[model samples]
Target: MAMALETLSSPIILFFALGLLAALARSEMTVPEAFAKGLAIYLMMAIGLKGGVEMAANPLTGEVIRAFGAGIVLSFALPLVAFAALRLTSGIDRVDAAASAAHYGSISIVTFVAATEVVQATGLMPGGHLVAVAAVMETPAIITALLLARQANAAGGPVAGSERGELLREVMLNASVVVLVGALIVGWIIGPEGFEPTKPFFVAPFQGVLCLFLLDMGLSAGRGLRQGWRQLDVGAITFGLYMPLISAAVAAALCWVLALAPGDSALLITLAASASYIAVPAAMRLALPKAKPAIYLTLSLGVTFPFNLTFGIPLYTAMGQWVGS
Candidate 1:
């Protein structure tokens, strides 16, 4: 309860709430798109570097390998569950359901970042390798989604003017993956001693930058909800709200099996629970061109993201503490 209150009242979450409320109220306040993109890049780079530095301090071990395996398995398998749930519960067509399922299976970097902050604030430090785990988890769900679409014969023909290998390029070379993996490698190469001089830029300002970025995210979510909510039926909307919990429960069971510590457990659970708004959506645009962006984007950014930020983090944290203890 205390953790939940703290999370809700944190400066970053509050800034997010402010932006969400502003947008929901139809306020015209806006962050420049270019600037928001810049913010995203900076956040990704900082996190990657930190994770890399941590990896440099520790050697890869069996536990780390297991965590990676678990992440990949989750990435590959969760969409099947999500797809099944959507098909069984909602009237959505296979293409849209598959696309939306992909989003649920993928990790949201921002949500992972937010969870890192909360976990650390509670004096539990997650492993740096989890960052690499996050990067690895982004693309497999996309593959699963495409396969699901293909199986249902819902993939249809490719979009006109689409060149072969375009989807592959987009999935592999997307900005999020490239920046994150690249930055992690750079940080690993430099190590802690080399990172000292750069702390002024990447370390000190990280929190404030995240607050600003999340405020923009809040605005985006609010606008998406306002504009797209009507497109969702009760079943679809409820899926957005409940799916994360289901994902988190699955992750927690995995953490127990793996015997992960509290901090790492919290982060992994949070990663499992988060849905991608950036990478998967862009890929879905190419691979499943027939899928409606409004459904997936709105569910991810509007309903799931807000729920995770305000309430889900605290609950996941407690679950982590329980399982780890």
Candidate 2:
């Protein structure tokens, strides 16, 4: 595990905690919602483009395929575990649990991005296609969660304002996935030499840009916690903290079984462990409207996201090293 102080000391995580604390303390620190949303788009695009450029530099290999395979399978499998756990432990009904489970199963690009930052901090080398792993992992859990809900007969009425295919559109075209995947394919087609032309804009300011993005993230987290935390019970709140850890453990074991390199294994574990805030919540709102956003989104965005950003990524990476190395 990463030393508590070490993780706490990270500028990114500290900024996150500051936001959480500020929100709880009722400090009116606010990011203009539109601006924050723009930052998010910028971050995703930058990361996606960078990953694609790197991928262009390195030819695809069996390891890349294996990592991607692991991502897909993990994305599909995590909701099953979360579904069983949520149903067993919480007061939530099937639809809520299934919707929530799908979130656990899906990837959080921010969390993955945060983990990439931590990996670089730790001097670890992960593949560019781990970004692709992230893209592949986004939707499987949505499918699984829907299946679980259907199997349990938990499709709770036409979820609020959500027409039939609305859920499909949300799941398939969430901004992060579309931009990330689209950019990756673009980069792949363009290749490394072709990437240099865009390097000035995409690569040059990534870190400073990331810090700006994180400051907005901090404010958004604080605001979210202030607005939504009342909906979480002790069980749900605890679930938020622990579920990512549990998912990470499962992903780590899978990576070990596949004998993946420590770096890629860590990325996979991080992706599995991170819960979706952007994509899943919107879809859940559409697909399972009765399920309280306060419980799941706050748990994900407010609770789990902060935890992973601050502590979980480093710890998961350390564990992946122990297992995969």
Candidate 3:
């Protein structure tokens, strides 16, 4: 309860709420798209660098290896679970369900970033390698979702004018993956001493930047919900709200099995609970052109993202602490 209150009261979350409220009220307030994109890139780069520096300081222990394996397993497996749940509970077709399921399997970098802050505030520092784990987790769900689409014969053939290897290139070289992984490697190479010179830029103002980015996100989410809510039925909307809890439960069990620390466990739980809006949408466009972005994107960005940001992070934090304890 205290944790939840604290999270809700935090500046970043509040800023997000403000944006959401503004958008829902039909305010014409907007963040410049180019600036918003820059913010996103900056946030990713900062997180990636920080993770790499921490990883550079530590040896790759057996536990870390196990964590990586667990992340991959969750990434691949959660989408299957999500697809089943969505198909059974909602009126969405196989392709749309598959597309939406892919989102639940992948990590949301912003949500992960928020959870990292909360976990750290709880005095548990998650490992930096989780960033790499995050990067690793991005694409596997994509593969699974594509396979699901193919099985339903919904994919049919490549979209006209789509080049060979285009999906491969998009999946592999997507902005999120590329910036995150590249920044991690760079940070690893530099280590702490090398990172020190740039601390002012990367570390000091991180929270403020995050608040700004999230405000834009809140606007985006609200706008998406406003525009796309009609496309989502009661069952689909309900799925958006409840599915994270299911994913969190699965991750909590894995955390117990892995004997992870509270901080790392919380992070893993949050990652598992999060649904991707950015990368998956783009991939689905190329791969499953028939799948409605209105459905998947709204569910992910509109319903799930806000829930995770406000209530879910706190719940996952407590769950992580309990499991690790």
Candidate 4:
């Protein structure tokens, strides 16, 4: 309860809430699209660099290898579970369900960033390899979702005008994946001493920058909900709310089996719980054009993102503490 209150009142979250509220109230305020894009790049670069530096400080242990493998397995497997649930519980068609399933299997970078803040505040530093794990986890569910959609008689092959390699390009070279993985490698090469020169720009200002980014995210989410909510049925909306908890439970069990530390476990749980709004949406546009963005995007960005930001983080934190203890 205390953790939840603290998180809700934090400047980062409060700013997000402010944006959400303003948007819901139908205010005219807007963040410049280009500038918001820049903010996203900056945040991703900062965290990628930080994670790389930490990873450089330590050799990759067997446990780290196991965590990486676990993450991949989860990424590939979760969509199957999500697809089944969505098909059974919601009125959405196979393509939409498959598209939505891909999102559930994927991780949200912004949510991971937010969870990192909470983890850091609690003085439990998560491993850098998790960033690598996050990078690895980005695309497999995409493949799975495509397969599921095909199997269910949803459109097969590329959408008209999509090149043979377009889906590959979308998955591999997407802004978040490229910037994150590239920055991580750069940071790994630079090491701590080399990163020191950029500390003022990258490290000290990170939290404030994050606050600004979250505010924009909140606005995006709120606006998406306002415009797209009608596309989501009650069951679909409920799935968005509950699926994260389901994923978190699955991750918690894996964390316990793998014997991860509380900090690491919490991060993994959060990643598993988060739904992809950015990466999956782009892929869906190219691959499953028939799939309604209004359904998947609103559910992910509006319902799931806010829930994870507000309540899921605290619950996952407690789960981590319990499992680690």
Candidate 5:
């Protein structure tokens, strides 16, 4: 209860609330698209570097390997479960179900970032290798989704104007993956001493920048919900709300089996709980061109994202604490 109150009361969440309220109220305020994109890049780089540095300090261990394996397994497996649930419970067709399932299988970096803050506030330091786990988890869900769609006879040929390696390139070389992996490598090489000079820029200003970025995110989410909520039926909306908990439960069970620390377990649970609005959406546009971006994007960005931000983090953190203890 105290943790929930603290999370809700934090400046970051409050700022997010402000943006959400402002947008829903139809306030004319806006964050410029280019600037917001820049903020996104900076946030990714910051988190990646921090994670890398932490990895540098810690020795390579079997536990880290297990965590990475767990992430990959979850990424590959969750979409199958999600696809089944969506097909059974919702009216979405196979292609759309697969696309949406891909999202649930992928990690949301922003949500991971937010969870890091909350986890650290609880004084549990998450493992640095989890950043690598996150990067590894991004693409397998897309493969599983494509496979699911193909098995359902929903597979289509290459999208027009798409090169042979295009989807692969998008999956492997997207900005988020590139910057995140590159920064992680750089941080691992530099370690703490070499990273000191840049602390003022990357470390000190992080929370404030995150506040600004999340405010913009809140606005994006609100505007998306306002515009797209009509497309979603009650079951679809209900799926968006419940699916994260389902995924979190799966992750928590895995965490227990793996015996991860509370902080790392919470992060893994949150990652599993988060849906992708960035990487998977782009991949879906290309891979499942027939899939309705409106449904997937709206649910991921509007419903699941906000739910994870506002309540899900605290819940996952508490769960991690319980399982770890």
Candidate 6:
């Protein structure tokens, strides 16, 4: 428990807390929306470049392919479990449950990045291909959730005033997914030697940029919790806190089966456990409009995200070590 508190009180989480408090207090402090968006893109590009450089140093083996494949499958499969859990445990209806579950199953690249930093701080080395795993894990849960929504609302008419293909477009080309994957591919094509040319801009500014991004995230989460938290009852609120641990435990078990190294195991488990704010939330806005974005967004972004960034990363990393060993 002391360890958990130490992890939670880390500078990154504290910075995030500062933003959350500022937003909740209705401080006029703000990061320009356009600037925030650009920062997000820059962060993605930096992570992708780093991953590609690492992959260049290592050969792409069968294990790498297997890991990516497993990530895709888990991303596809976990939504079913999450959907059932939401239906059984929360007041959320079918459409909302399905939409919310998709977010839980999808990867949060920021959370993964944060986890990577934590593991590195602990002197553990995660595989660079984990970035590829994150890329592969982005879209499958969105697809599964859409399929679930289609089945649940089959008898009912289509969502009113919703355009055709909006959900599909959002799922396929959400800002986070497009940037992360595109940058990953760019990095792969350029390789480490190629990435060196842009290192000063992409590499050096990363930490400060992340701090700024987290500040915005904290503000968004605070405002969200302030507005939408009442929608969550006790059961629902508890789910936000506990589901990541559950997901991580399951993913850790999978890591053991796959014989993943400690570092890579932890990274994959963290990705599985971290719920998407970027891709899934935007998709929910279009796909499940009747569903309250505030509720799920706040729950995932406001509640669970902070939890994962703070204590959940360390817990999962420790668990991954125990299991992988």
Per-residue error for 242 in candidate 5, Å, reads 0.6
Winning model by lDDT: 3
Question: Scored by Cα lDDT, where does model 6 land?
Answer: 0.84
Q: Residue 229 error for model 6, in Å?
A: 0.6
Query: How much lDDT does each candidate structure score?
Result: 0.94, 0.82, 0.95, 0.91, 0.92, 0.84
Q: Give lDDT: candidate 1, residue 130.
A: 96
> How many Å off is the CA of 252 in candidate 2?
0.7
Q: What TM-score does structure 5 among the candidates reach?
A: 0.98
TM-score of each: 0.99, 0.93, 0.99, 0.98, 0.98, 0.94
Q: Write the per-residue lDDT of candidate 5 for residues 33-58, one digit (tens) a residue.
A: 99999999999999889889989989
Q: In model 2, what lDDT does residue 162 have?
A: 50
Q: Report the lDDT tens digits of candidate 4 across residue range 114-232.
A: 88888878888789888988888899989999999999578675556767888899999999999999999998999999999999999999999999999999899989999999999
User: What is the alpha-carbon RMSD of candidate 6 to the true structure?
Assistant: 1.9
User: lDDT per residue, candidate 3, 1-325, as tens digits?
Assistant: 9999999999999999999999999999999999999999999999999999999999999878988988999999999999999999999999999999999999899999999999999999889999998999999999999899899688788677989899999999999899999999999999999999999999999999999999999999999999999999999999999999999999999999999878888999999999999998999988898999999999999999999999999999999999984
The per-residue C-alpha lDDT of model 2 at residue 104 equals 93
After superposition, candidate 6 runs with Cα above 4 Å error: 1-6, 154-165
The sequence of per-residue lDDT tens digits that candidate 2 reaches over residues 1-325 is 4454676787767677776677778787787888888777778887887788779889878888888888999999999999888877777778778888988999788788878877767777888889988988888998898788888567745644556777788888878788888888888778788888988887787666677777767777777887887776687778888899899999999898888888888889999999988888887777767667777777778888888887788788887777775
**Candidate 1 total steric clashes:** 0
Q: Return the TM-score for candidate 6, rounded to 2 decimals.
A: 0.94
Q: Which ten residues in a row have the lowest lDDT in candidate 1?
A: 316-325
For candidate 2, the TM-score is: 0.93
Decreasing lDDT order of the candidates: 3, 1, 5, 4, 6, 2
